[model samples]
Target: MTATTLHADLLGRQDPQMADVLAGEARRQAGTLQLIAAENFTSPAVLAALGSALVNKYAEGYPGSRYHGGCEYADLAERIATERACALFAAEHANVQPHSGSAAVLAAYAALLRPGDTVLAMGLPYGGHLTHGSPANFSGRWFDFVGYGVDAETGLIDYDEVQQLARAHRPKAVVCGSIAYPRHPEYSAFREIADEVGAYLIADAAHPIGLVAGGAAPSPLPYADVVCATTHKVLRGPRGGMLLCGAELAERIDRAVFPFSQGGAQMNSIAAKAVAFGEAATPAFGSYAHKVVANARTLAGALADQGFAITTGGTDTHLITADPAPLGVDGRAARQRLAAAGMVLDTCALPYGDQRGVRLGTAAVTTQGMGEDEMHRIAVLFGRALREEPSRTRTEVTELALQFPPYGQ
Candidate 1:
């Protein structure tokens, strides 16, 4: 049967309950703009592969092998995914399991270090994710986590201070990545620091994987001993984590991901990952990455022009963190106002102060076909909402979003 007929037949069989839920979600996505730094919408092709028949399989092992029956097709799907991920990231190995970004970080840590080993990580309030070493997280509980904060004067990472801390702490690994950080870390500097302290370097490019793959940002594959990321964020794939490492450490990484960290892999997600990798390999994806960066910068500048303090001065990637105090508002107030205005972003607290900030990104809207103009316009709407009543701004923002509805609805 043809592909179109197959889709029609499948939709014909959808139950009333599921159909209503799906339709409501479609309407919600179509009517709003997603500005969260950690979120992105996947392509329809990726979605199709995610919900395909491959989910029925019980493949409990790596490709070309399985512990259960009926894995011939599953093996092919996973092998294709593995090869494509390796090629896209130019890594010696890629483990497409881990289920989530947090899982990937946990497994990489489990494989690379022993319990109670000292770990140097970015401070949570300074843009580092919870998995990096928030006291409430497993990483902090299992490991001796020492946090490094951004320079107070500039609000950027202080590598000299980091080196000093690494030398003092002699950590087992130095973890680098952020959810709200706008600038890229100097990986070479970090490598040198790690080497100086006899520590391993773990680069979590979960937020910028797509930009790195398209050459819009620096690739950490060479400098990092192991790299971990989420496929959903900038890569715009299914919700999954990937562990990439050099050939020498491939075995340990794979073992840690499988028997040590998780059970049977999500074959459907792996298949979608392969599709996402194939999509990211094209030249247009390069353009898309570039646009994401440009849109972020544009949005940052627009907000700054409205008197908001753009964190780290401006954005060098697809995200920006900004203080909302200039508009006589707090991060929570701004986030709520934006949500009511048909836009969504996150509110975050700064490390050492009562001040709060909002994180904005371009991945989702850019994936929905927005460019610099739309991003700037959205920033204006955000500014007006923060400065005025949310009800006044909600009407106009809703009108703006209607111009480019979500795809596939």
Candidate 2:
């Protein structure tokens, strides 16, 4: 039979081998502690939305107009997704068509910039994303992206230097937010600098939107001309992206996302985004967001106690970056050992350094109902997995994971 005639469970029935690999991933997720900074386990509701029949349709234009027929229901789903997004962020307009964060970033660039326009963004090794301005990425190749790094001593953005670059280069857009920076962004300062240079401030709050929505971090909506986010990280949404902007830029942004950027929107992911946005607006999600940062501090303190060097001395958010020099372990090796012990996180590069550190977050653990005490214990497990015996740590981690099953018992 052709794919169209197959039932919804096509993979499980006809592609059992690939389905087993997927099941193995799910098992690994349930059995291990996920500390990856950018990853989150979306709710079963979001998963259901992803698997819904919405995936079978294609919508090429905005809700009311479409390039194809049979998009009535698709339009409603996209409208619901866009409305929820605007409500969640209190923005006047939202475009939820971009497929990934990088796509969103690219769309934003296409909306506001011509080729060869100068853009100022955080450096990649200094917690910025590849899309931000890594020389190897399209953002760098297409436009002149002058990166501003963190202060050498404090591991924080140098506002003075940013202003200097703004004065010197007068970039068309100034980007804020980073993939791994633990400190809350100085959005107001960024706004002031952008204003002085007549630059559009684009805040890439991909990693911290949930915290911002929960009031744990400063909101960039008031300061940013265009805000781009992945919706998957802290917001716990499906894998997609959105642009929150003023009504004045909404049509331009829509055009950029539709004709200039990606085609045929992912209706299913947009439906999943609506569901996750509903979950995020709850009081329970607010408490969970606060606890995520609290757990991070506890974990960082515990690691400090174990003599591991936290890059910024601590964290004010869900994640912390730590150098492994003190542990006498390579960051990659540390990650492998921790994964073996059923504690999973990835290694990352610190500012002005090689890939010599590991980055971990408490979002997933806190979402799974783990608390400060668990954070401390997890830190100890990190030390044991790296500095001591792996078998003992693996057993301990398994026991602890049993207490807080990710979704349920």
Candidate 3:
């Protein structure tokens, strides 16, 4: 059936309060499986908090101490957020004010090093985020960053090479993380290299923070001088970023996050973050994390079986990267067509190659109650979409999606 037909049927009965708009959006999200590695749908509770009365206040400073009046309630919310964040990540201190992961990263960099100071990090197009050291970003223009990459053969980071670069360059800080990497990063190896070079190590665990909280993934907090992440993806919260660090660096990190990078904190977002933290601290979240990783593994295996190259051979987290060019579909085109059929994923360049891969993650879908069985169906849909003729795979994928439908439908 056509989208208009589907739209009319699905949206015709929505509540009068949000009848016209709400049903159409629900149709979009319910029809599609969101696979964007960096994206996820917020829970209703989180959405409620985001649109709550907390947004009306202007809490321009930390808890208790504020630059504005009438902040008593705001103070309580911020304190709850801060305490919950520390507990969730097992950090001595947590700053939940940064508007985004990029902002948190920039604040960390600014707090750690000065302009023109040399730092070591993963190369862009090799899993590292743009804020890490992309020339187009402020991090690159403000600091001199030397990058290290993975072994060309094994398709994994070469720590020895990183050490060599560190020894030769003697940078002030070493950033370890990725946006598209599938394998687990060697934080110990990165820490060793940093110690040898007398450099600080920062882990950007934005993608795996939930898994880490759930005990399914390694905690970078134990080894990192500072860790940065977003509360939405994986963490399953409202849209915002946070910084976790040792007590010794708490003051600097906090200052950088506030007047240095942003103004008043979004108290509502903080309240939602507290809720998400509470959720992540439960055993149920641990189960969800386990399933998220398993689903990714299943999807990876299926894609590899279809002759697509799965980066790092497979995934250790909830994300999978595939080279779609071999199947005669570039990353961009595949993503667009998949969107048309009700699947949402991002086209991303591989670690060392051009834009030959499509990156997808299972966090959002798993949160929506999908499991390995659903993963197999999704993978088969992906394979069909990329492996067969477009006209042939289109209807099949739509039908497969209908089987899964969507959560909350």
lDDT of each: 0.86, 0.86, 0.83
- The list of candidate 2 runs beyond 4 A from truth reads 1-12
Per residue, candidate 3 scores C-alpha lDDT tens digits across 299-328 of 899888776788889999988988877777
**TM-score ranking of the models:** 1, 2, 3
Give per-residue CA lDDT, model 1, range 1-409, as digits (tens).
3222323445546665565566566666667788888888787899899889988877887876678888889989988988999999899899998799999999899899998999998988788888888779899789998889998868899998899899999999999888878898899999999999899999998998989877799999989999999998888899999999999889899888888889999999999999999999999989999999999999899888888888879989998888988888888888888898888889886756687888888998888888989977887888888777778987787676667665632
Q: In terms of TM-score, which candidate is stronger, 2 or 3?
A: 2
| Candidate 1 lowest-lDDT run of ten | 1-10
Clash pairs, candidate 3, are 32-342
RMSD of 3: 3.7
* Count of clashes in candidate 2: 0
Question: Which lDDT value does model 2 have at 342?
Answer: 92
Model 3 alpha-carbon miss at residue 251, Å: 0.5
Quote model 3's TM-score. Answer: 0.92
